[model samples]
Target: MTYFNKDIETLPIDKLRKLQNERLQHQVQMIYNTVPFYKQQFDERGLKPSDIRTVHDLHKLPFTKKDALRENYPFGLFTVPVSDTVRLHCSSGTTGKPIVVGYTKKDIDIFSEVIARSLTAAGCQKGMKMQNAYGYGLFTGGLGLHYGAEKLEMTVIPISGGGTEKQIMLLQDFQSEAICCTPSYALTIAEMIEKKGIDLKSLNLKYAVLGAEPWTESVRAEVEAKLGVTATNIYGLSEIIGPGVSQEDFEEKGTGSYVWEDHFYPEIVDKDTGEPVPEGQTGVLVFTTLTKEAMPMMRYWTNDIASLYYDKSAKRTHVKMGPILGRSDEMLIIRGVNLFHTQVEAVLEHSTDFSSNYQLVVKREGTMDSVEVNIEINPELYKGLLKETSLEDVLQHEKIQQAHKMLTKKIKDEIGLSMKVNLASPGIIPRSEGGKLSRILDLRSK
Candidate 1:
């Protein structure tokens, strides 16, 4: 219920549109005058800053994609000199070149403010102790959450990420009430608590804001039950000012995440067509930075798949984005069928018997392609089975076999692919050490 900036968050839609229009216009002019990237893109199209007078004219501009960032390298897209940029962050791209982004002091403040708003929405309160597990340095997760938590007036335990043993020790010792980390890492910690037989009363955590990877309702359910907290999603990217572009409200779980539109105006566009889509239709997300001073983005293609709509019954006035279905540019093509891992994740979400943790392994066999899904068995069920039988014999159990068959059939039926589903013993798959977990392994190239 508490808002870091209630005035902007609850601005009337009409007035919000006017503000967005003004900011978008200013951002266009600023970028066109200073950055070669924007100037070149606009000039090539015979466009001028004055041509884009409002958010409605945003479609007239070309999209700034990750390739543009890569082509610009360290500082080409920057509107100001390097000295004016206060801090920098880079994404660990799949290729050799990393996508770098910079922020000015004001940009940093904007980042903190949006994250402050995000934390408040995720059920965090002032004076509450926050154990920030998001990693720091070059990567924006740790410091991003740290500054925001401080702005929110909570006691911040800047523990960073990893050190499973130390994280647990400090959580019990300090009794931090909220945690921030990747969903996979959170699950690893939850599993560790049970496997180590740690006392539940020792932990005082109540809220978790998980992101940097696409997760499902099943993961949320697991984290909530295991950690005894209300887990919500906080979404962002290195290019879009880190983990506060939008956030899911603690009370409104599946409704969507409210985008901080005053700063980041959002539009959903058809991935292939590169045109805006109708409201509620799934497409690639595009954002035009309205207030970023360091490196303002113009219709930056986010690649994230989701639709946006105005949630009439919400605490904020900003448009809400549905849970990211998957990445548009990264969707896998297997045997002529395109799929996102999250689609398979949805199957796991519907099944209460399986663990949310899983990985996709893609391989090519003599002119043919195949997919194998390795999913972790529920820790509680595994632990229970160990009491009666050995780990090897547990797989022979009828319930375990049935669950595996059901999951495989579900994936086939829903995703339209016959993926080989393997139910692994809990803790068999590798977990996130500190950063984002790579969920897919494509061996076709090899």
Candidate 2:
């Protein structure tokens, strides 16, 4: 219900650092003693476990990248022996080779505590029946939340994902109070609920912990309106022990997720320079898993870009990371202009009164690069405008022009990118056959 470990969760700044230092020291020793990969890294750097004393000393260690995890494959990074490993989870790398992570029983318990804290921060309580719709299997989202909910004594319905009928049926019959899944899935489920004429008010759902993909505030509002539940963004990666690294405490507005700094240390650095950026400035998120048992990462580059704000009201110094602005690797340069997919999505979020389902198509026309946005407007909204004897068809084109102009200016101001935009009819944009949404399609011959 409340803090799982109240002492640690609310530990004073000085005490928390002390705890972190101890954990960091222990983790370093464990890695040096057991994990060959870390042993080699430390040896190459001429460093010893004792070299890392305070949490700030983490910088002395080399940053871990996704490639390192991939290169290690299944178990090269394990600080503990495989015999002590209790669980294994692999990322759903739709792009290439999947990154695998192993967790000991102690590691799993720590992860559960972190997720439990996330649920509590989002106001989930004991005895509340929660429907966890996040994908389970090798992906850590579903199971991470599943164990956390159970640890918090909340009754959990492990509905995996992608069955709209079953999800609604359980929401009705079980009177589930919360749902956890990707933001896109939440919207898709809301669309299904409306299509099926389900009474959202009758369902006892109160909160939705949505993440796994970048989503806009407009989508959050849409989900809340359709499902009649307060929505919160929960962020994490399989590399950092999923779903509990950071979470938006809705009580604090859109102040971003409050990073659980006790378990994992957080930092923001200039993407190019790799130096620490100012607190309010946007930069790529880097993390160090200070207390993980199976795999402890030191200065792992997360690639996510956002600004970090320290929230003092919570008494626990929580790191508030802005909405994942975009991925560092997803940045595109067109005619000496740099831009990201989230910037395009931000423009769409403000200018479109349509369904949030959309796509960004980037292609090279001759030697010039062009960007086009394909969006779908709701028929009902269009009908309302058409009733005023205003030709909705013509107005749609005007809206497109307006969106294009606003987006072009915004992109130019934000990232110095000049782009072209286009709009498409509702349901025209492609959806992932596997039920997930792909945000970008770069047709540029790389």
Candidate 3:
């Protein structure tokens, strides 16, 4: 299938910038004229729509934050009339208040196109059958990929998440070509595939578009090895437009996600200063939807820290954003050192004995902060270690010490912090009853 707007997707760098500038100018005027929130914000800043002539001038526009959407509640920054809004979705708000987003029919169409483009970039073809395991309903993952799969004329099995047994059954019976879901769920499914002893070669599955949660290369390798599929990352936020912001092409290794700039203008800026960061430097990711009709933000701070670089190989002039490092709020300050959950996960992943199911607990001990990594070791390995030697207790204790030493060194290297590590049995580590992993258990006092 060919893109409806090929020029924008394949435009040269200079031409793409010109198109973005033109769209930015028009959207600024449109929002200023119709949206009360933009009007008030611009009026307070003493800025006119004419001031935003180029995409670089977007720095002058106020940045929209999650609190702004919460303060507005519903339908606050919508550019089009409420009557024109055809659909709406709200964020899960795992962190804070849920932000509601409205979408006109045009906006929905653009969203579908962007998602389809992302699928195509990941090498999804028309004749292939896909099993969409992303959750539906209030969450955007399911419906976003569902619509895009249909748009691509791929026969879709709308298997909305959960029910691992049924999902695997259909995956095998239907000979599915691709699956779309979060990286965590993908790993879970892969584990199930191994437990069932299913021959992945017999099934038709080839590719997977995994997102919704930040994942590391180690996890991707695990998923690919287990499922026998090429894994690609798909990025989006409900605040912007779900599942279509950017996507990774399988041809590249550790390359940034190629932004769908036709509908959204992407930028990276200094998190503290709100000034544009130099290319290839990590900073806050910001986006402005140029063609969104219902709600088009001028500059929305995504809180995700990543770098952006122009992909010379793609020749599309679209900025590719690096993998999200971690959330700004999720960063922990321990003894004046910055720590992230991913750092802990990376260290744990490097150890074969460490189970993927683990949690990081950051708590205060008197005058200083302390970190404890509670990890679960695979049951088989634990049992084998116990049976094979009289040094079971010694081995376990030494393993914890080894993990602590390795983690301490890695953390010191990454963020200059040394932390304590603790080990537990396979199921000893606390997780959600439903088997969901918890990243943090912060007990810092206010």
Candidate 4:
């Protein structure tokens, strides 16, 4: 019920659209006159900034793809001089040079404001202490959440990421009420808590804001149950102003996260056609930085797959965006059926004997590709059912054998694929070291 900016968050929908239109017009003109990449895009389409007077005309402008950012390289897309900007952050792409983004002082303020809003949405109160576990430095997750929590007037413990011992120590000693990190890393912390036999009540943690990678409700359930916190999804990408782009309200839970539409206008478009899809349908989510000064991106393609819709019965008037299913780039085509790791996560969540820690390994057998899922059994279940047996001898256990067969059949019935399942003991599978965990290991190319 506590909103950071209640007026803006509860503004009338009609007024919200007007605010977006006005900001969009100014943003279009600013980018058209400033950034050459956008200017060239305008020229190629024989369109002027005036042509984009409203959100409806967004379709007329060509989509700004990630390739444009790479082609522009460092500072090429920046609208202001480097001296005028206060900070710079870039993507951690494995190949080629990383895609750099600049932020002016005012833009940094915008970032802080959105993050404050996000933290508030995640049930972070003004006086609550926050243990920021997000990575710092070139990655924006750390600093972005740091300043925002401060903006929300909460005490901050800048632990950054990794070092589970230190994280737990701070959580217990400091009695921080909130924690922010990737969901996978949250699970790692939770699993460590169990292995070390740390009493959940020893930690005063109450809320967890998890993002950076796509996750499922199954992962959320694990984090909440283990940490004894109300966990919510906080989604954002470096290209679109980091982790405050949208946030799931603590009370709202499974509905969806509210997209702060007044600043960053959002649209769901067809991944292939680049045309806007009907409201409430799943597609690639795109955004235009309506209020950004240093790097005002117009129709920047996020490549994240999700749907946008208005929750008429929601607390906030801003549009709500569904959970990110998967990125178009990360999706896999097995045989003919498309698959996202989340689909498998959903099945794992329902299975009482399995833990959410899992990996999908895709390999080529002859000419066809085969997927094998290596998942860990619940530590408690392992302790009760097969503590005497070695992990390699797990399949020899009759209950393990039955669970494996049931899991495989469930996946086949639900996901429409018969994938080989390997049930490993807890700690056998790799855990996230306070970073984004890669669930899919497609080794076909290698």
Q: Candidate 1 — which pairs collide?
A: none
Q: Decide which is better by TM-score, 2 or 3.
A: 3
lDDT per residue, candidate 3, 86-158, as tens digits? Answer: 8888887876667888988888888889888888877788989999988887778888998888888899999
The clash count of every prediction, one per candidate, is: 0, 0, 0, 0
Question: Over the full model, what C-alpha lDDT does candidate 4 score relative to the true structure?
Answer: 0.91
Per-model TM against the reference: 0.96, 0.91, 0.92, 0.98
For residues 1-446, what per-residue lDDT tens digits would candidate 2 score against the true structure? Answer: 24556776667778778888887888788888988888998999999989989888877777888999889888888887788999999988887779888898988998898888889888799999999998889999889999999999999999898777888889899999999988888877887788788887779999998888887787788889999999998999989887799887757647778788888888888999888888889998998887888888878898988888876775456567889877888877767766777766665554445667777788999988877666666655555656654564634566545654666676566655655555555556764322357778888885
Candidate 1 vs 2: which has more TM-score: 1
After superposing candidate 3, which stretches have Cα over 4 Å from the reference? 1-6, 94-97, 378-380, 389-408, 413-415, 428-437
Candidate 4: clashing pairs of residues: none
Cα lDDT of all candidates, in order? 0.89, 0.80, 0.80, 0.91
Please report the candidate that would top lDDT against the real structure.
4
RMSD of candidate 2 to true structure, Å: 2.8
Estimate the TM-score for candidate 2: 0.91
**lDDT per residue as tens, model 4, 295-408:** 888888998999999999999999999989999988888899888889999988767888899999999989888899999887888887656787567656888888888999
- TM-score winner between 2 and 4, please give it: 4
